[model samples]
Target: MVELDSRVETRDGVALVELVVRNPTDTARRFRVGNLLDGPLWPPRSRGVPEAGWDDGGFEGVVPAEERRALGYASPLSGGARSDSLPEPPAEIVWTERAGETEAGNDASFAAEATPEGVVRSLGDHRPPADAVPTPRSGDTVSTPESGRSEPDPRRSP
Candidate 1:
């Protein structure tokens, strides 16, 4: 079984989220995920971030060949562009599988929390610093591909 845990922290008004992906397999694998938090509590509507499935990297996340990677910084939650309903943490994740040694998409077990001030209330202006931008991998210029979702195991409790 795989484990998926999500942590949400509000710093300087920006919602910083970290998704931890763990694979129990002997070898490392790749996983794709998006809308990891797209559900009722975290409605598609946003006052902070672009729609989960929008231009924001498709399924918008990738768990690298490492056994465990915290995927954040790349996707930060924003207070809705027009409203105060800040975005909630993604509640789910789907890892990708290639043909050869690829592993099937395992359901990510999920968990979430917010700072006292970041508890799904109204938000303030908290854009990232212009210099905090992420660097591309070596010479890769394109964004990571959007991921397809698979049947998440029964543990969907948030």
Candidate 2:
């Protein structure tokens, strides 16, 4: 069986997420992990809002090819004989944020057992600087304060 774990953290307005895929089987197996974007949560409509799938943010690297073969998969990249595409398991997993938001979608599913044995980090912080202007490096552009003609105190800027 495959197991996938996802961890999310937010810092400075950015969200950091980490995904760990593990193969518990004695043999190796190939697998794919995709991020689900937007979908409805399980139980339907009671949650009052839709959820975001894995693709909504970021994803970890592809599962190793050798591992796929060990799992008896005809082709690691392909979902196998179950269908022209990979099979979709029941909606057994659900992730919710502290803000009462939920994420769900078809692509949200991943080989949990194929995930690595670590935490998943996602970064979502995008706050602008408090008062300082950004300067370009190695270019002929000069960085002046909002005054457009004078340089401001560097200490006051971020």
Candidate 3:
């Protein structure tokens, strides 16, 4: 499971949020993290692969939170300029697995902050913090963590 924390702070003239993600699994998995409303949001890719579920217009990089925002990217939960029509920011962590896909079990909100190192420390993973968000997976559809969802057969194709 992925643990994410979202909180708000200010940058430039906009209110932004920071999302911290932690990979509890022992094996390093390719993942994508992003704001649902802003099309594709930021650390665009990890371990090389596209880290599923990310939309277009997403940038790729691994840096601290402060540097991400300084580059003018919206916070993961900012929702850009269409907040009224979009659902609350559905920031998530996603990865590809035989089960088709999997998403972090929670839908958390976030705001911007300056503590990039703190965010990285909070993530508890070795990956550098950056502005890129992740993609979503089919695992997101299952509401329970212990639901025992079956993994897709690797031999099969979508």
CA RMSD of all predictions: 20.4, 17.9, 19.7
Q: Give a tens-digit lDDT track for model 1, residues 1-158.
A: 34677776655544555667776655545545555432212323344543332334334333334366555533344444321344554445555542135432332212222442333223543666545765444434333335343433222211
Using all chains and alpha carbons, the TM-scores for the candidates as numbered come to 0.37, 0.27, 0.31
- Of the pair 2 and 3, which is ahead by lDDT? 3
Per-candidate clashes, comma-separated: 17, 42, 21
Pairing residues by index, what is the TM-score of model 1? 0.37
**Which regions of candidate 3 are displaced past 4 Å?**
10-13, 38-87, 96-158
Worst 10 residues of 1 by lDDT: 104-113
Please give the range of 10 consecutive residues that has the lowest summed lDDT in model 2: 69-78
Residue-wise lDDT of candidate 2 within 1-158, one digit each (tens)? 54666554433333233445554554333344443322211211112321222222222222332132111101122122222222232111233112111211122222422232111212222445554555534324445756676444454433
- Candidate 3 on 48-113: residue-level lDDT in tens? 423323345432223222222112234444444443444444454444221112322321212222
**Better candidate number, 2 or 3, judged by TM-score:** 3
**In terms of TM-score, which candidate is stronger, 1 or 2?**
1
